[model samples]
Target: MKWSEISIHTTQEAVEPISNILHEAGASGVVIEDPEDLVKERTSVYGEIYQLDPNDYPEEGVIVKAYLPVTSFLGETVEEIKVGINNLITYDIDLGHNRVSISEVNEEEWATAWKKYYKPVKISEKITITPTWEDYEPVSSDEVIIELDPGMAFGTGTHPTTVMCLQAIEKYITQGDHVIDVGTGSGVLSIAAAQLGAANVEAFDLDEVAVTSARLNVKLNKVASTVTVGQNNLLEGIEGPVDVIVGNLLAEIILLFVPDAARVLKKDGYFITSGIIQGKKNDVKQSLLQAGFEIVETLEMEDWVAIIAKNSADTKEG
Candidate 1:
């Protein structure tokens, strides 16, 4: 079978939404090529060598690629995707170059096309994200290694938003903390918390695919004993009162759960939120403040923001 390669030149903020649009349009999977990776310094600490080519990335913004079977309705599907992408602007999402391109390739080519774009990288000082197919070794005694296979789910454990959440986890998670990972795509954050010695961790995602993928990743990380993956909308019905709550979700979705997060979060508990575009940074911060959270710190990478806050509700369940 042949496939049409649909590639969008867009902003980091629009990557998730556009990727969703493509998925809904019947794309088998999506590949993201962000220019930031070109300059990312990777280590061969495990003696595994991989090289990245600059031409594979756009000079600015990012290129999101997806594969759709070449069919009679291919044109209609592309049009629908275009319309969906354009509609995002009404919601205040930046489209960057707003360029879309299409190409044709065989199924075999499409299968291996994305592999060249993914590689192991040291996302944080102590954390390294290596793809499941790669061989890597710890460079230091304190290094944390995450083996991930994104598998059409969102979290690669290297995206800026996810990376920020992992970094926050390493710093704020107590040795025996009970943690909740909201919208835990691929369960990367949950697995990270579990590996970090979290006594218990709950991974929640509304998408069934994400739930299954997260469960597999959690097991792959050998943290099934500590981390549990489930499907749930936001923080609804989450009986938390936990030490740490983290969500890497869109700013709008994050706003919807701020109040709920504050409700379940124990007094002095930590809240880490990411997947926020730079433009919506303040809106999310204000929402958190309104929900009885004190802003601890804000981290920025590329064009994304991650906010760490502390629940100041003054009510401890225990």
Candidate 2:
């Protein structure tokens, strides 16, 4: 089998949405090559970690890559991907050059090459996310290592929003807490919650591919009993008062679940929301407030924002 590597030259702001477009186009996986990884100041936690070659990254913008099957409709698929990328501009996403190119590769190369792009990334003060192939040892006894393959799922636990969400989880999750990881891509957060001592963790995603990926990761991380992965759209149909609910989702999707989140959390229970771009920060904050949540803290990393709120009282899931 052969695959076509679709590479797009774009800005960091458009990375998430564009990646989604590729996934919807039937791409097996996505790879991001951002120049910011070189000089973004990770001296504290990652500590001389990035060894990326400058030549591989564009000096000015980011490159997003994905692999799709070289099928009878390959050309049509590529054209559709281009059209989807062009559509992003209407949503105010800067595409930079938006230069897209395609190249052919063998099955072996596509299966193994992308793995080189992933490594042990120390995402937070106490968390280090390592891929399964990488041999990583804990730098400190307190350091928690999350091994993930990611596969076709979006969450690698390294995105700014995800990192902030994990940090928020570290700050708020209590022992024996029943936690719901809404939009839990790759089950990374659910695994983290279980490791952090949550007795029960429900990892939910609407996408079946993500559900399969999350379930695999949860089992691989030896948290099968502690974490349960399922398909659910945001917080819909979820019941029971959970002690903590964490979602790393788009600002619009986050808004959809804010009211439901409030209704399903116990009084004083925490809601840690991420995946919000800076532009939608106020909208999300306002929605959270309107839903009876009191914003306790706001965390920002790069151009993303994560809001930590608390449900003031117990309410039924409506």
Candidate 3:
């Protein structure tokens, strides 16, 4: 297998924003590591005491990495992967005084090297994610089951953005409530809503791959009928008002779609949105306000934020 390592050395404060930019720019599965975490482990005995110290540490830095499979990313020569790395400078940031570097890993290894990095991620106490190829046993009592093969789509429930949306739905979803999930990737949010007892749910994604993956995941969990998967851009071509609506999308998309969300939401319905980076929560909130939503609650996990807003009768929509 061949891989390219693109390392961005920046102050710890910029790590989250940089990661978000990279993700929005088409990088998959970004892994961020604070320089302090790389400190070497040591054991010494002083009156039965043990100690660990750093061998060598940069004053401040973080390694944000995006790993891709060789066959999918590099192929035979890996020239495309190299180009992809070079094209990753899409982020425009005033880094004070820092430089980013992209390099290639020229080596020969087995094809499945990066597969070991991914493991079953449990979204909640009752939910355990088992890859499509893996065998899993779902307890008869628990209603949660998520089977996924994250091919190229996002939101496999490992990222903070996905987790926040799932947590919000689990906290408020009631049995037999109608639910709608916009920009549903891999159908994680909708599946969780279904498992949590929403009577009927419809999930849509702009990407065809995401729609396909979401459909497979819905079937994997045996909730295909209750949860409809379709190809739509932000609820376009969908009809009717649902009891609860969830959108796991970037802050910009959330703001742009807030009015449309209000248009289809029933009076006093719930609206949950995530994929918000730091310093942008207020922007989404204001958009929601202008669209006639009353703020219910907001959640923050790591650098991602999710807002739960309620549609009130006082607001008018186009």
Candidate 4:
């Protein structure tokens, strides 16, 4: 099928609002290019580990895109969307590709497409990730557990954020801790937490794909009974006090949700956060402090930092 690929370019500041504008302007759906996801997920694992220079990357803006069929009855549809988008977003909007062909793809092919991209990933002496297509034999002495075919979503223990979260879980999580993994993309951190002796792991993300992917990952890891994955925002839909909260998201979102997290965490509960750029470390620290938490330790790896902190008793005293 032929699709009119309407791609709009905007500044980082305007990406979200412009996306909303584009949706109002009558498009099918918008695809926002979040470079932060790639920076936090892909680059830290595959790209340079300890020395990520964000400036070396693009100014890091999203492409708000939607599709219109060639046979659509809307005349000057692109122009209408463009003008409405321009009014909402003060930035210039470059209409990228007009028409691109799309084909119906099957689930098997789509899931296995990453096979060529994925190889046997050895994160630590304890955990090794092997794609489903490949038959990998592990030496008996390695003491390595296998995560067979992490399907598709994110997180295969290969991304830096996932690696960092797993390492943090392995290090700090105690037995019988109720763990909440907000933005549980592919349920990597939650599953890791469950495996690491978290009593119960409740995981959620905004993306349905992420929820499905997370469930698949949990099943792949055989932690389905321990970890629960769903589509929800950071601790908002979840009730009760969790002992530990692990969020592998951009630093800004972490700061925004820390207060709620503080509310949902039991007194002295730990909040382990990663996906923070080196430059944003101090900001996150200050935000956590302001959110009524004490920074217990900051783990630095590959130019990124994961902060482990405990909630203060006086969080609600204000």
Candidate 5:
């Protein structure tokens, strides 16, 4: 079988949304190659190692790549993806170079291209994410392992936004707590919450493809009984009073449902939000404040920010 490799040269800020566009266009998997990774300082605490090659990355903006089978509708699909990415400007997202290119590869090459980008990495103190095909051994007795196959999903659970959310969930979640995971792509957060001892987890995603991918992941992690996956727009129609709520989504999307999040969480319950760029951090923080949430902690990695807020008892529930 032949596959078309679509590569987009864009800013790091646009990676999330652009990858979503590719997935919606029926890409089998997405791979991100950022030149910064070649030079960024990695912590040695987890003994993380990288074998990145300078030749594989662009000198300036990040490159997002996705693989699509050579189908009769491939041309139309690519055009639609381009249009979707351009429309992101309305949301104040930076496109950077935004140059797109395409090439052909056989099935064997396509399989190896993306898998090499993912590996077992310890994102938090106790949580480590590894691709399903990797045989990873836990470095510690209490280490939590999450095996994920990106499939048609957006991330491998190693993205900064996801890392912070998983860390926050580990810190705040009490045993047997009920967790509501908004924008639960790949269901990584939901699976982590369950592994950390959450009795019940409700994971919601607006995209049906994501919902399916997440459900499959939950089952693979043996958390299906604890984590329920469904398709829902943000927090709409979600009845909460839950112990914790976690959303790793765009700041604009996070702002849309601040009040809903506050209403859904129980008094003093936690809300963990990420997928926010540095420039929009203040906007999300202020919205959380106005919605009766007290900013508890802020986690930043590279250009991304994740906020951990607590719902105030004075905030009225819906």
Candidate 6:
């Protein structure tokens, strides 16, 4: 078998959305090569091992790589991916160079090569995400391990937005609480909510591929019975009164559904929003305020932000 590696040279801010585009186009595996990783500090407390080669990364911007099988429809798929990425500009996302390239490789070589970049890294006080191929044991009695196979998913569940969202979920979710995960890519948050003792979880994604990948991951993490994966736009047709609502999506998308989020959440329930850039922090905060949510806490990681807001009892349902 042969695989074609599609590489996109773009900005760090564009990585998540561009990766989503590739995943939607039937990419088998996605790998991100950010130049920042070369000089970024890693703490041993989190058990992160950094063995990155500078040569593998671009001098500027970020390079996102994905593997697709060489097929008759390969060219059309690539063109569609390009169009999808270009469409992102309307959202005010920075694309940087936005150059794309492709190369062919042997299946055996490509399958195992990208695995070296992923290792068990503790993302929070209680949660550590490890690749499915790695054998990792919990170092403490309270530690929780999430095993993910990124080859079939959108991300490795270790991005800053995801980490902050998971940490917020761990902090707020109560035992047997009902949680709803909006834009539930890879179903990581839904799985975590269940693992943390949530009685039930509703996970949703707009992309059918993401819905499929997330369901696969929920089963892989052995939480399928507790977490339900489906396809739906953010907060649309969801009648909650759920204990918690979490979304890790672009700030613009988050803004679009703030009122719906407020309506579905139980009074005093938490809304955890991530994938927001630092500059857009104030905008999200204001939206949450208008939607009758009181800002509870704000979390920052690098240039990304995650906000935890509480839906007030006074919030009116339209």
Q: Score residue 22 of candidate 6 by CA lDDT.
A: 87
Candidate 6 matches the true fold with a TM-score of 0.93
Report how far residue 36 has shifted in candidate 5, in Å.
Answer: 1.5
Task: Find the candidate with the highest TM-score and give its number.
Answer: 5
The runs of at least 3 residues in candidate 6 whose Cα sits more than 4 Å from the true structure, single-residue gaps closed, are: 42-49, 154-157, 314-318
lDDT of each: 0.83, 0.84, 0.66, 0.64, 0.87, 0.87
The global Cα lDDT (0 to 1) of model 3 is 0.66
| TM-scores of all predicted structures | 0.88, 0.93, 0.69, 0.64, 0.94, 0.93
Alpha-carbon lDDT of model 4: 0.64
Looking at model 4, how many pairs of residues clash?
2
Clashes of 1: 0
Model 1 per-residue lDDT tens digits across residues 137-254: 8889988888888766432226777777888899899899999999887788898888888999999988776787788888888999999999899888777589899999889889
Worst 10 residues of 3 by lDDT: 44-53
User: Candidate 3: TM-score?
Assistant: 0.69
- All predictions: root-mean-square deviation over Cα? 3.3, 2.1, 7.6, 7.9, 2.0, 2.2
Query: What residue runs in model 1 are displaced by over 4 Å at the alpha carbon?
Result: 23-26, 40-50, 69-80, 153-157, 315-318
Candidate 4 lDDT over residue span 1-318, tens digit each: 444556555544444344444444444434444355335644323222332234423345544445555555544776676566555423332333322223333444444433443456655535555656667677556434546444332221255555677777777789899999888865767876777778899899876656766787788878889998877867675665778999987676788888888888888988999877677799999988998899998877655678999999543332
List pairs with backbone clashes in candidate 2.
Answer: none
- Residue-wise C-alpha lDDT for candidate 6, range 108-146, written one tens digit per residue: 999888886777878778988888888888989988889
Give the alpha carbon lDDT tens digit for every residue of 1-318 in model 5: 999999999998899889888878888888888877667676643424355567878898888989899999999999999999999999889999999999999999888767767778787789888889988889899999999988875432267777788889889998999999999988999999999999999999988889989998998999999999988998888876888999999899999999999889999999999999999999999999989899999988878999999999554445
220-290, model 3: which lDDT tens digit per residue?
88888799998887977665577899988767678877887888888898999988877678989998898
Off by over 4 Å in 2: 46-48, 153-157, 316-318
The weakest ten consecutive residues by lDDT in model 6 span 43-52
Worst 10 residues of 5 by lDDT: 43-52
